[model samples]
Target: MENSRRSSLKLFFFVIIFILLAPQALSESDECAAEANNSCNNKARALKLKIIAIVSILMTSMIGVCLPLVTQSVPALSPERSLFVIVKAFASGIILATGFMHVLPDSFDMLSSACLKDNPWHKFPFTGFVAMLSAIVTLAIDSMATSLYAKKQSPGTSGHVVPEGDREMGVEVVSGGENNNFQFHGHHHGSVAVGKDDGSKLLRKRVIAMVLELGIIVHSVVIGLGLGASNNTCTIKGLVAALCFHQMFEGMGLGGCILQAEYKLVKKVVMAFFFSVTTPFGIALGIALSTTYRENSPRALITVGLLNASSAGLLIYMALVDLLAADFMGSKMQGSIKLQIKSLAAVLLGAGGMSLMAKWA
Candidate 1:
């Protein structure tokens, strides 16, 4: 176990080092002009649009994220319901497409921009390489964190994590001492069985919430900065609307995970607050840095591209393995064919809707 833990840490560090240095290896100096001016370059109008975007995005994000949390008050939205399963599947699909169709492509575009160094940046695929490495690193963190948290929860207690086979076969095994195993069948006095099932699962959900939020925030800030620094009133007007919708959908995805974590009210409020303000804060920062910051500059392209790639990898992995796979393979979906079909349709709709938004965003 010690060897395995050490190996995981080593692999994690290696990936981090590679991610940091990959840009250097791929760096080249290629000068290209910034985007051509198409919109009225009025400082006062641009400032007004930025302020409007900041307010609009903040409100929409709060509404989208808070929607899921508030739904917990309604019995119909309970986690056990088929409707809940379908809704979550749809949210997961939105997250998946955001990673693949939105962020990953953005990273590719930035890294492959003509403003960057040509010899390495143009010759090699740094975006995919970083994204691939980022995915591996994310998986390592997920597994290791889960194992560590589980161990902490059961400190010095020696017992198997009730086998999956036993759980599925309607048997709940409670081990208190060596050779002392109690098996309970069905829901007869189900308190112990339910506790055993929920214990470890809760920890996993909390981790997913925290990591998913980080990934989403990275993308949010990058896009916000791009929008905030723009002098194009025409472009900003359209983008403000598109971005409001973008944050709303993305918030719904993050909000679903946060809701599942079953956090205390204070923690939920804090998370929601942070998600809602991140874009606005990014915009504010961009406004402050607009004079010196250029999005198409070599440094900007490399930094944002790498960050986007890393976020893409993290989001994709969490949506696929943690959110989508866990639910799709769980007992709820497995027991109902109709629910599965409905859930699949929801997934496609969610994905399609997000993909369509990407065209403008």
Candidate 2:
């Protein structure tokens, strides 16, 4: 009877403790639920705005990028025309601005966000470093691909020897045996033909277009993801207009590259499709992942910030070195000071516009 009474007493005490803690646990759970509901509401609002922005951006991008390609039919806009050169210069300038003003800055902001740890992030300029590395990688890819193509097309050791009949085209030997001279001329013509077969400027342009598209796509998707994940109405409103203009200008830059490539209709369409849809696709993905994703969360911030930095580096490098420097230094721009100044002004205008958009976007 004594042991049974002690056991009951212990059980009674345990029950009292559980009862005392139950309200606190319930209160915490309720608070968590409220927080989650608020988050969901915010996400829902952002998702709706993102849908509209995606559609608008897609249309703007398609129109902008397709303009130059479609303009090929106009005689004045033909690749060899002066007007075309000027237009291309303007487009290159825009791309240069985008790389420097827009993408790079965004990357810096993301990587340095307070959500991330201070030890490595604040200690080192990871954004700049990543960007620098990306640029170097891009250069490596560009140079190596060009060199490989050159080697593949070279006729060294693989050139075919001409047959006697093909080599001898009826050159009668005159006073000092002009036949030998004729034979030497034939050898020179053969070498010229081989060289023509080996190298092509068209091929180089195509490679450039493909690589540029890849770089552009990286940032496009990231921007779209950001827009999609955001639930702030104030942000979305401003972003809609800024993003529309952003896509349009970027499309123009890409369009200029596509035009230079001289790709077939199918290839042109493919390139255009990629640029147009990347952002929208990113938005869609963000919508799908919104439930689990927290923009300011440590993991999310680090991943996104690093990605932006790397992409920014690539854009900056390509814009300044590959596109601007190459064209401005080329014979076309060098021959005309007026055109150079116009292009410089255009670049500044583009950079300014994009920089302003950064305030909201």
Instruction: Report every candidate's CA lDDT.
Output: 0.76, 0.67
How do all models score by TM-score? 0.82, 0.75
Clashes of 2: 0
Q: Write the residue-wise lDDT of candidate 1 on 1-361 in tens digits.
A: 3323443354345435533543342223543557677557777899999999999999999998998899977888977677778888888888888899989999999999887778899999999999899889988888897787667645444633442233444654455556434365765555333344565687788778777777787777777877877787887887888778778877887888888876656667767887898788778867876776667768778888998899899989988898888888888888989888998898898888888878777
Q: RMSD for all candidates, in order, please.
A: 7.0, 18.3
How close to the true structure is residue 353 of candidate 1, measured as C-alpha lDDT? Answer: 83
What is the C-alpha lDDT profile of model 2 across 1-361, one tens digit per residue? 3322433344345435423432222222112121233433465677678889888988998998998888889999887776766666566666666667777787687677775668888889988888889989988977786556545533342322221122244322212332221223444454322222222454455556666777787777777777776677777789889888888887887898878765555567767887888778778766666555566665555666776777777777777877778678878789989878877777677767777777877
Model 2 bad stretches (over 4 Å): 1-44, 152-200
Model 2 residue 255 lDDT score: 90
lDDT of 2 at 353: 74
